[model samples]
Target: MVVEEREITVGGDARPARFTSYDVEDFPVPTGREEEWRFTPLKRLKGLLKGADADGKVQIDVDGLGDGVTVTSIERDHPLVGSVLSPVERISAIAFAGFTSGTLISVAKRAVVEQPVTVTLRGEGGTAYGHLVLDVGDEASATIVLDHSGSATYAQNVEIRVGANASLTLVTVQDWARDTVHVGYHAALVGRDARFRSFTVTLGGDLVRLAPTVRYAGSGGDAELHGLVFADAGQHLEHRTLIDHETPKCRSRVAYKVALQGEGAHTVWIGDVVVRKAAEGIDTYELNRNLVLSEGARADSVPNLELETGEVEGAGHASTTGRFDDQQLFYLQSRGIPAVEARRMVVRAFFAEVIAKVPVEHLRDRLTGQIEAELEGSGV
Candidate 1:
C-alpha cells in the first residue's frame, strides 16, 4: 500500500512539452502524505503511475453560447492564466510522467454574461488529464457549467476566480463512463463583496474524489457550496470542501449530501472552515449528511472549524450520516406506495433541498432529470 507523493511546484507559464521527461519512480505514497487527500484510495492510484503516454489530442466543447454570451479563447500567453493553471498537469505528470496541455477561460470586467457557458471535457483513446481555469472579472455576472465525461479513465483539475463585486454561478456534472477513475481539484478566490455559488453532482465514475477549496478575501462577501453524491455497487466517492475567511464581514455556508448502496460503496465528506483573526464580524457554517442504503455500504462526515476572532456575528458546524429515515419510509409505505419506491421517495426528498438551490434554471432542470433517473433505479 504505497501512496505515491510528488512535489508539485506552482506551475508557471510552461506547458507540458517544454519540461525534460522523467519516469515516475520511487515516489512516496500520497495517502497520509496530504491532509486534503487523507481518505482517498491511494492503492488504486497506482493505475495513474503505471506511466503510460497520453491518448493524444483531446477535444473540448462549449454548448450553445447564444447572443449576448461571448466565447473567447483565453490566450495562453496571458500572465494570469499561465500562473493560475490548475494542477492537473502536475498530477498527470506524476502518473504518466509526461506532459499534457490544458485550457483557460475568462469573462470581461463589468460584463453581464446572460447565457450559461458550458464546457465539456471529453477523453478518448486512453488515460489522460485536463486543466480548466475560469476568471470572472469585477462587477461581472455569469453562469458556468463544466461537464466531465467521455470514453477514457482520467483526472481533472479546475480553478476559478471571482473578482471584487462579481457574482458567479458554477455547476459541475461528472457523468463519466462507468470505467473512468475521476479525481477533481476545484480552487477559488472570492473577492470583496463578491458572490460565488457552486453545485457539484456526482452520478458517475468508478472512483471519484472532488476537493473544492475557497478563500474569501473581501468584506461583505458570501460563498455557498452544495453537493449531491449518489454511489452504488463497487463505487467510491469522496468530497472535501475548505472555506477560508480572511476578511471581516464575510460569510460562507456549505451543505453536502451523499447516498450509498451495494457492496463496498464508500463515501467521505470533509468540510473545513477557517476564520482568521482579521476576519472579524464573520459568519460561517457547514453541514454534511450521508444516507446508507445497504448493509455493505459505508459513509463518513467530518467537519472541522477554526475561529480566531470573537468579534464575529456567528459561527458553527454540524455533520450527520445514517440510513434512510425509518419514519419517513414508513409514512410513505403506509400511503400504499411500494417499499422500494417509498424509500427512494424519501431519499429524493432529502436531496431536493440542495438541488433547489441551484441558481441556473437550465442546469437545475438538467440535474433534476439526472437525479430522477438515478432514483428510478432505486425503485422510486
Candidate 2:
C-alpha cells in the first residue's frame, strides 16, 4: 500500500505531519514498508494490524494506593479518558475503539504521596486491548510503576498529564513472557513549571514496539525520557520517541541504551525533537547508544532534530552503535580481574547510569539483577 505524504506548517516551516484519528478504519493495514512501521515485523503482531476484536483478557491490579490517590474505572466516553491523548497509529486507534473500560488514577491537588503506586497487568491469553490515564494535580508529587507480565498479544494506550508546578516520575517495565507480542503508545503533557521523568525498561517478549511522545502545555516545562533494552536471540525490540517544544523556555532530554546478544537479536531506537518558532530559549538534547555483545546481532539508532528558530538556547542529538570497547575490557583484565568478571563489570557499568536514576531502591536492585541474569544466560 502507498501512503500519501502530508506536511503541516509550523512557524513558517513545513514539516511532515503524523496522521492520527479515533476511527480504526481511517488507518489502513500496514505492510511494513511505511516509514513508521518499517522496522516492525507485521506478522508477529497477531492480527492487531487488521483491527481485530480484543477477545483476550488482562487482569489489572494496583498496590500502594495512598490516602491522596484514587483509582477508578470509567467507560470510553468519560470526560478525562481521552483528554490528554489521541491515537497516533493503527494499533493504538484499534485499542481505543475496542477497550471496554478504562482505568484512571488521580492524585489530589497539592498533595504529596510518599508511597509509590504500582499497576500490574497480567495477560491471560489471546489478544487484548487496554487504556490507562494518570492525572497529577497541580503542585502534587508522586511516583508510578507499570509492570507487564504473562503471555498474550496486547495493545495499549497510556495518557499522562502533569499539572502546573507538579512533579511526576513514571517507570514502565516490560517483562512479558517469551512468546508474547505487545505494542503500546505513551503520550504525556507537561504543564507550566512542571517536571516529568519517564524510564522504560524492556527485557522480554517475542516482538515489542513502544512509541512515547511528549508535548509542552506551558512555558518552563521540563521533561526527561530514558529507556533500556536487552534483546536476546530471535527477539525484536523497538523504541520511538518524539518531543514537541511549542512554548518558550521549555527543556527536554532523551537518552536510551540497548544491548544485543545471541544470533538474530535485533533492536531499534529512533529519537525525534521539534522546536517551533515560539519555542525560543528552549534547550534540548537527545542521545542513543547501542552495545553489541555477540556475533549475528544487529542494532539500529536514528536521531533527528528540527529547529524553526535559530534563537534557541541549545539543541543537539547524537547516536552511536558499536561492539564492546576492547580497550576498556583490556584495562580491566590487566588489573587481575577474570575475563568473565571483567566483562560483567563493563556491562554493569554501561547500564548503571540509567538504573541509578530510579527512585525506588528495590526496583533498581531488581533491574541490576535482571541484567546480570541476561548476561549469564547468554554466556557473555
The top-ranked prediction according to lDDT is 2
Judge candidate 1 at residue 221 and give its lDDT. 85
RMSD of 1: 6.5
For residues 1-380, could you state the per-residue lDDT of candidate 2 as single tens digits? 21333465666764655666788778878888988899988998889888777788888999999988999998987888878777878899889988998899999999899899999999898899999999999999999999999997999999999999999999999999998889999999999999999999999999999999999899999999999899999999999999988799999999998999999998999898988777899999999989999999999888989998888989999898988899999999999998889888988998999999999898999999999999989899
On residues 1-380, what C-alpha lDDT tens digit does candidate 1 reach at each position? 12323332323321111122223343433554566556677666535545445664336888756544445544334455434323332353353233355466677788888888898877563766666678888988898998877656566556688889999999888887776777676878888899999988887877788878887757988899988898887788888888877788998999888888888888989998877667889889898888888888889788988766678898998888888788888888889998987886778788888888877787778777877777776543
Candidate 1: list runs displaced more than 4 Å. 1-27, 31-36, 49-52, 56-58, 66-77, 82-99
The alpha-carbon lDDT assigned to residue 263 of candidate 1 equals 84
Instruction: Quote the lDDT for 141 in model 2.
Output: 96
Task: Show where candidate 2 strays beyond 4 Å.
Answer: 1-10
Model 2 local distance difference test score:
0.90
